[model samples]
Target: MNQPWSGRKLHFVGIGGIGMSGLAKVARSLGAEVTGSDRAQGGHDARNVPAGATVVFSTAIGADNPERTTGAPELHRADLLAELTQLKPTIAVSGTHGKTTTTSMLVHAMPGESYLVGGEVRSTGTNADWHEDSAWLIVEADESDRSLLKLHPTIAVVTNAELDHHTTYASSRDVDDTFAQFLARARDAVVAPDLTRLRADAHVFGEYDGPLAVPGAHNRKNAAAALTAIEIAQGTAELARELLATFEGAGRRFEVVGTANGATVVDDYAHHPTEVRATIEAARSQHPPRVIALFQPHLFSRTQREARAFGEALAGADMAVLLDVYPARERQEDYPGVSGLLVAEHAYDARPGMPVIWAKTHATARAYLQRALQEGDLLLTMGAGDVNAIGRDLVAHSEPPGR
Candidate 1:
């Protein structure tokens, strides 16, 4: 369908972000002329920016950004979503984790459905798709910035509630309260049974018995949530189960980047302590010879808040390698200690014989991993930040053992 922004020129600041890029792609698909600039040096310049284009940006972009200072009309990603939600029947998938995977599963179950997932779906090679004929619009609702509160969804699905994003919430109670508010706004809702504090009438999903292609018990829960959401949307649960059985998984959620020297390398976006533990458990369930986990802590605030918990979670792995924090939008000076050091100290304290190594840089970590990985080992790169590159680089540089 033709959106109101069709035929208009749009430019995005911090366009490299998954959500921003998804919006840009959808706008372009709807016939809007789209361009964007990121912090990537020399990636964008005034020469390429179209004159009088509407400038769009996310919370991550700063005022000093060259593209943002162009004096063009500004738009926030949340504003765009708010507008779109008003126009169509919306289904918002929310939670501290599994938002991306569950949203992708829902989209996969309903072919040709319009969706804006937080991460790329490997099966589709894109994070967002705009289907003109479909009346439904599915979005991965981000609770970090409380943007999910802005969306007026006809159906809302909460995968699970947890205390993260300390910047937005003061405590776990605050997080649960905000989620309750979001759910209250929805006409119908589906949620994990653990989140029973919210209204009980909401469809609560438990363990799914249907076939699943993705590994891990968490994925089964994700599938169950997706199936319940599909049923709420008037879709068949059986078909969704069948599609989920063949689901290849979304990008960076236990994504097998490649294998080298008989060792399988997997990458996952699991930065939180709970997520880290779950990902480690998933790796263990695969019964690999050894699971060597390489983790990069995402934000300084998060690391500061959950350092001990992060260390405890890393104990689940046979061996652990910690990389310096990614510090996405935070300044290092603002935080007390380096995330890697904090996690390393606590991890060693928690698991004395677990063999934890603090590789302060990518080069150091790569070198250490190359020499350490043995045949039949499962090398897992876990984090929400750029640590996924480690697995990709390993895959690109190493050859099969027999080769």
Candidate 2:
């Protein structure tokens, strides 16, 4: 069957974004002429855009963007997924956390299954893939903008639920209710036992005792969910477990960027408090020595809502460095008194014995980390924002130990 997007010229406004880039790659793979632009300098550029292409923009792109004024028909990323789900047997993974990891695992277990994941699968080197003749399609259903509701998957996987995206959800209950609605629409689902809204055919799974390449108990739970989905798809769980044991994990999910001064530098996308705690615990399990964490809060709204919780999570680290808030799409002026300092203050109050340093800028934070990081330590750069760059830069600039 010919792909519906074949012969179409597509332009993505913010192609550098994780989700947008995934869609762009899928479109290109389907034989569409694809080009893109991002405000950031290094991503897609104007030179690559074809003449008279259909422009697609995410919510982050402003009306004033040149591509937005091109008068091309606009399509949201979610709209594309909705159209695809209508045509394929979709398995959508939706949750407040572990969605990417679970989706990647399913893709690994079932070879040749088309997928649209939010992060790059280290093994595959791309986030999204197109298999024109495949019967199944897997995706990371995002709940941040309530976009997961648009997908109608044959099977859904909800890892766990928590209150996030303060702008979309009114309360924790609202978040849970939204997830329940998403699951209700799916033909079948595999969820964590704690989710508790399973259908007759739906399955609930707990931790797996089998060996896994990824660290942490949470990953064990993710592996269990993936195994259940594989079983439902009529695949062998034993084979899946063997494949999972060799999985290198998705990018930015406990990715080991490099090593410096005898300490391993890890980059992780963990913004929520629950995620933060899990990532830190994973680092401790691997390193066993001092775990030095440098966290840059992702959004102002999230920081304002979960400052105390974030502080408590950071306290688990042997030493914590709080960088300035990334603020993604929000203006700093709109959310006053919401910054790294707020988290530092709360963490100090909660765990006075553990040291928390508030470094308001990247320069200060980098200097502090260089001086503080020593042998037998794990340096974890954690957040949902661009803080991952700091870890890469630190490794790139540092000399080998004993230089």
Candidate 3:
């Protein structure tokens, strides 16, 4: 099954990244010699990379990176993923929010298939796996850089499409068009009812009226999408529905850290306004006395473009704390006058009486949260960055004496 990748040597320049690490695991299991390096230097992640291998990198790796100048041939990450697609009938899941969870659901429902997901699958304890004897490959397709267009999937699944990457796509229409093109290239497509406006001929997945192991109405919809995709590719959803009930979901998709000070701490990767609102709404299902949202806005452009929407989403929480914009791959100087306060101010206006603070520093944000959180409260951290560490710390400090 891994004919082309057998015995091949591949070194990942940024192996710690969820996508890269998942890909590396699958390639290794398929008989590729895998090695990896990360910006973490000699830390645990970098030290764990195989001793030596030929260079492999992604679009995120700059040409000036020392690893890129090794004079050895290198492979693009996306290109490697496309090669895997050639050997198996691929089920590619792409959407603004639920792609990771949806892909993980499909993999968990239908076992013994190669899979590459952006986040760790809770049930499997890993993001990607390889099965030489399986006939399928499940991938969490990324649309941020329009890279999802490269793979030719046997069945393409779109949970829903929206404008999330402000830089890559100029408008929501561009996002829709890209998804339409993606669906058009697939042999079959299972899409959200909202997406029918883009591709009517594509199968319109019905909402699953069954129970789910995961929380959130949004997750129920994701399950429906996964089951529908399974039905299309395999002609049955009977067993898939049962398996999905055991699905714990992918990491950072409403993951709960232990309780801290009698309050539950949950973490989520919800940078967009829609995701933020949905996650908070899901938390409300726990029926906590109060929901405290600790959010770190991801990009300057997104915070600027969706500040009001972000505020509206935050209003769903009982109280909210906003950390400064996390300028990932974007410089603060380039985004002058744009910061998390933009959203915080809007949040303040959304509910003048609600407590909303814009903490410019992570330390201050943590301190504020530590002081404000109370018993019976639920702390839900949301971001695309490392904000989950804060929730973990809170849980650690509140743990009972020695284990």
In candidate 2, stretches whose alpha carbon ends up further than 4 angstroms from where it belongs are 42-52, 198-201
Q: Model 3: per-residue lDDT, tens digit, 209-253?
A: 887877898998899999989999889989998898788888999
Better of 2 and 3 by TM-score: 2
TM for candidate 2 is: 0.95
Residue 361 in candidate 3, Cα distance off native in Å: 2.2
TM-scores for every predicted model: 0.96, 0.95, 0.94
Candidate 2 per-residue C-alpha lDDT over 162-217 given as tens digits, one digit per residue, 9 for 90 to 100: 88888999998898888888888888889899787544456898998887889999
What would you estimate as the lDDT of candidate 2? 0.86
TM-score of 3: 0.94
CA RMSD of each candidate after superposition: 1.7, 2.0, 2.8
**Candidate 2: 10-residue stretch with minimal lDDT:** 41-50
Residue 261 CA displacement from its true place in model 3, Å: 0.3
> Which wins on TM-score, candidate 1 or candidate 2?
1
Global lDDT of each candidate: 0.87, 0.86, 0.87
lDDT of 3 at 198: 72
Better of 1 and 2 by lDDT: 1
